[model samples]
Target chain A: MPDKRCTEDEVVAELADGMTIGIGGWGSRRKPMSLVRAVARSSLRDLEVVSYGGPDVGLLCATGKVRRVVYAFCSLDSIALEPHFRRARQDGTVETFELDEGMMLLGLQAAAWRVPFLPTRVGLGSDVLEHQRDRIRTVRSPYDDGEELVAVPALPLDVALVHLHRADAAGNGQYLNVDPYFDDLFCRAAARTFLSVERVCPTEELASNGPLQSMLISRLWVDGVVEAPFGAHFTECVPDYPRDEEFQRAYAAAARDDEAWAAWRARYLDCGGHDAYRDAAGLR
Target chain B: MSGPAASVGPGPATRADHCVVALAECFRGDGEILANPIGTVPMIAGRLARASFEPDLVMTDGEARLVAGPVPVGVEAPDVIVEAWNPYRTMFDVVWSGRRHVVMGASQLDPFGNHNFAFIGDRRRPRAQLLGFRGAPGNTVNHATTYWVPDHSPRVFVPAVDVVCGIGTDRARALGPSGRFFELRAVVTNLGVLDTSGPDGRLRLRAVHPGVAPEDVQAATGFLLPMVDDLEVTRPPSAAERVLLARIDPLGLREREVRTS
Candidate 1:
């Protein structure tokens, strides 16, 4: 097997403009913040981000990198709403395809299964159908039942960025936390996938680190691996550390105004690289 | 009846305690189903239900595990007995199975029980941007759904929701057999307990908290709420229930979430 280890910048370098990028993690937990920071600092434009969004979507929207967002919700968990993403939506900065959470999951699953769409009854009577009428279509069952269900289209992505607790140079990733979210699905649904991990362990150690079920991402689906410690900073990585509530509060506070955002961007986002961002944010 | 009534035991039951018990009563018969409560009071209510009356109800640790026991609220690392691992992905299996009863918060709720937490004004650009159309669309359509509104005001109890994130009685009825599993169980607010159990399937004043008159609830609502003929006061937490509430919420986080004043 090839050693697919790369830098966060290298992962960002592989991404192109107008690409659909699937971000892993569910609402501010286990996000690839290092890689997301690299994307924020990069000149990538007109990107469509699909996520169970948190600050990843917020940062992308704040940096003017996103042209569209396909999401169920963009929340900070503890913080009810993500401020930057809220501002972006309020300003009509990006086009949105807001689906039911289950619909989004089915879409990703459809892509991973190499199917055009997966039929479900999630968005039947909600405004989701009205909002996403252009993209989502209904299909009647071919069987005797003839029940109509929402055909959640494949959410195929150009690239996927995920953060895991540990990974091998061969690109197999494992999550130490209880919930793996949808990182594996994101990786399989994307054409290319990059994983950033807290540590790069030997392939054998990956199995020993945790249960076999924790090994979520297979090397077959991953294109690159970046060993960026605290890669999921500000987000909870469980046994390693919890979410930096204070830092997240500061981030949310900055999004209140352009000047505050600019100051925060300079102090954090534009500060050279991931290591510098950590140092500036006082993350030891 | 006046609002501040004495409880069966312990201290006088605050309005928050009444709301908690009312919210807990929402899951009284939801045996063995997953009780996924979203907000603070709802969380307390879910645990309260599980700890006391509805012991068969499944509860999570507010993260990923199906906890066998009621984990204390606001405790960083409470001793939890893990029954099963329920990741976000795996949760869909439970959600779609119609085996879950969720008590979620609503930014805007209408007489028909349609909820809107997506956006306020318009789809293109709204006045306020709340949590988008999350699991509301799916949850409402799939299983038993309830709403826990900590604040019951004209703003929340709207005439009609701006966006229907959760399918109401009207929309669900339109789906025919597709909406077979849809059940808008109840809506528990700070002021009173409301339900869409009327013949027309519209929100009706089921019961008011102690001191809160049915007229007061209707006055605070954006539209006139139909009153149940036998409207009664919401049950206050008993001394045993209060002890359980304290055990579940040792930090008194429920008080912070709901303010009677």
Candidate 2:
């Protein structure tokens, strides 16, 4: 087995323009902010970002890196709406392929299963079918029942970026939290998967960290494992720390104006690298 | 008929209390099913229902576990008695099985109970971009769904929603057998309780809260709301219900969600 250890820069280096990148985590919880910031800082353009979005979508949209967004909802959980993503949507800055949350799940499942599409009754009569008429299609069941279902197309991604609590040198990842929110599906659905963890422990210690079920991402699915401490900063990583509400508030406040955003971008996102970002963000 | 006995320990029931009771009553006969409630008032209501009358109702710790008892509001990682582990992935299994009853918030709801939390104004360029069509589409179609509107104004109770996230009665009926499980159970707002039991499955005013007039509800609504013949006033929380409400929401978070004035 190969040691899949890499850097955030190396993960970002593999990404190309116009690629569909799936981001793991839901709402404002346990996002790969380090690699997201790296993507934002890089010159990546015309990217189609897929996510159960939080500030990852908002930050990318604010940095003008995203050309399209494939999402169910972009929320800041506690704040209801993500300010930057709201602004982007209101401004029509990025084309959106919004589907039902279940539909998005099915799409990822379809890709993981190597199927063209998965049929479901989630978006049948809703505007989800009407809005994504070109992309999402309906298929009648071939069996005797003959029920019409929405065929959620496979969302095959070029790359997947996820943040787990711990991993090994061989790229086996584990989540210490209660909910492993679609991280494994995102990894399995993508061609390449990069995991950023709080710590890179030995394979023996990794197995002893938590229950067997906590081992979400296996070594076979992962391409790289980057050990970035506080990698999911500002987002809650449970057992480690809660979401920095004050920092998130500041981030939301900055989205009010371009001047405020510019100042914020310079102070946090544009500050050299991950180590500097932690220093600027005052992450302890 | 007179209202229920004056609320015990918590003083007389305020508008928020009435709203919570009304919201809780939505799950009255919902025996032994997942009572997934969004927002502050609905969360309190869900717990209130479970703690008081509907003990069989299943609740979550707002994360993963299917908690045996009702967890209090705003308390992160409290000592909970776990029933089962339900992650986001497993939630869909429950959703698809029609075993869940969700009380969600609505940004805009039409006459036929079509909900829109996706965006306001045009889809091409929205005037206000809210949380996109999240689980609403799936939730409404999958199982019995209800809405809790803190503010009952024309802005929220609209004639036609900009984007239909939750399939309404009209659309659901059109889908034939596919939309079999679709049920717009109830709509509990600050002012009153409504149900889609009117002619042609239109929204009908089921009851009004104490002091609020039927005309007031009609005036606030963008569309004409058909009134039920036996128009009843929404009952205030009973003594036992109030006691449960206090335990479920000790910090008075429900008061902040709705207008007490």
Candidate 3:
């Protein structure tokens, strides 16, 4: 029988320590906060995560769930520029490989295509790509007059865990937002993809619009789907829902001191497991 | 009529005054404020942090693919908008999707109004080899493009470019609305402002901020700069704009100050 869709608890239990994981969503939009909270409570630790700019990586660091990360930038858009990522880099708590916001998609695509590298001429003079020669290698291009070029290798993911607006029990899901291509490419390249959705609606009822309908994901690539409501709050953004600026302001204010961190750690980070955190996130 | 691109003669006091005055105009009712990209980190996040014209939930660029950015504060996160280069069919989607706003930087811009993505040379090849025109042609026609010439140099504002990677008024006019529309909005330079209108491809001087002079703009430009009527000095940041700006970007981006060379 095809594997039954497991609860958030079972999913967290399956995640072992030190695995490379990919979290879903944009800056504050579409984050798998429930699953992230669930992962925080588990005994497993030090899982390296690969993600673009967002609070998910910060959440992972705040909980001590991440050991290292391969990312471009992480911050709260201005509230408090990602203090966790900044502090980690400054203190050497975690190793980081920064890329540009533009090159983010290509890197994942490179991984998904299973190609060794993808060539582009993005950061030639800028300091953004200066130190990242390891991740980005300079090579000559055939298109140019033997001019130097750069190649960014594919970033294949082990498990792609993305939060969605709706899904069916079978994992045939569709994202309500206009964009699905961001995580869509990664899902194809990853070994297994996990989808944590807000509502599990019937496939036929996904959407009536043609553009939105074309972007839906079939059940073949999705390994599991977790039903999560209000899960994208704080980390993931819902268009009409409004971002929690108050909480972000509070987090920025509190991040200034060790005492504050301790309080935060005790209150939020140190969950016994998924069930407790789920209850906190109002997930029943 | 001197023509839109021709010298109408006013510094910041006049022509560019419209754009300047219009800055706070969009925000009249409730008032919409578009944060300017001034400093580094703060500049990067300015669009999201601004109280005016704030995103209801936050959105990524392009009408097609919502390349997720970090979900805005406190609100529930959307799928998250992240930028990508060749996100497979993403570029194709953006280009094909009718009208879209894109901001990109240019190193060299010529007199004929053509932009150089390939190495800059005159009739043939007379200059150093730069990053050859990468995606200019496709993007310029495909989207409502804006060329952000960060380092405003004479070489950049040239009479003609070596390689024709991106489209200019000539190209856009040829392509019509099916192609690119807004020829040039504001050439936000370190010195002053350069905006154009007429079909002759003439560039007029719009503004010379507080310290900037018409001479400086002329000396720095690669082509003949035009003049506008009744120009005033480009006003410095207001108390409110400055305070919020500092709060957002504590670390100064690129140059140290708002006023640059």
Off by over 4 Å in 1: B1-9
Tens digits of lDDT, candidate 3, B134-241: 345444544444454545678678776555555566554553333333334445555665555423655566666666678887888877777787665565434443
lDDT of 2 by residue, B1-261 (tens): 122322346476889899988988889999999999988889989998998889999988787889977677765546788999999999999998899999988999999999999999887689999989999989999999999999899999999999999999999999999999899999999899999998889999999998899999999999989999999998888876776766677777887887766
Candidate 1: what lDDT?
Answer: 0.90
Error of 3 at A226 (Å): 0.9
**Residues forming the 10-long window of minimal summed lDDT in candidate 1 chain A:** A125-134
Instruction: Give the least accurate 10-residue stretch of model 2 chain B, judged by summed lDDT.
Output: B1-10
Q: Across residues A1-284, which tens digit of lDDT does each residue of candidate 1 receive? A: 79999999998889999999999999989999999999999999999999999999999999999999999899888897999999999999988888888888899999999999999999998999966688899999999999999999999999999999999999998999988898999998999999999999999998899989989888999999999888898988888889999999999999989999999999998888888987997878
Worst 10 residues of 1 chain B by lDDT: B1-10
Which model is ahead, 1 or 2, in terms of lDDT?
2
For each candidate, report its DockQ versus the true two-chain complex.
Answer: 0.85, 0.83, 0.06
The lDDT ranking, best first, is 2, 1, 3
**Each prediction's Cα lDDT score?**
0.90, 0.91, 0.55
What is the per-residue lDDT of model 1 for residues B40-113, given as tens digits with 9 covering 90 to 100?
A: 78998999999899999998888888997767777764567889988887799999998899988899998899
Best prediction by DockQ: 1
**Across the candidates, what are chain A's individual TM-scores?**
0.99, 0.99, 0.86
Better of 1 and 3 by DockQ: 1
Model 1 has a clash total of 3
Cα DockQ of the candidate 2 complex: 0.83
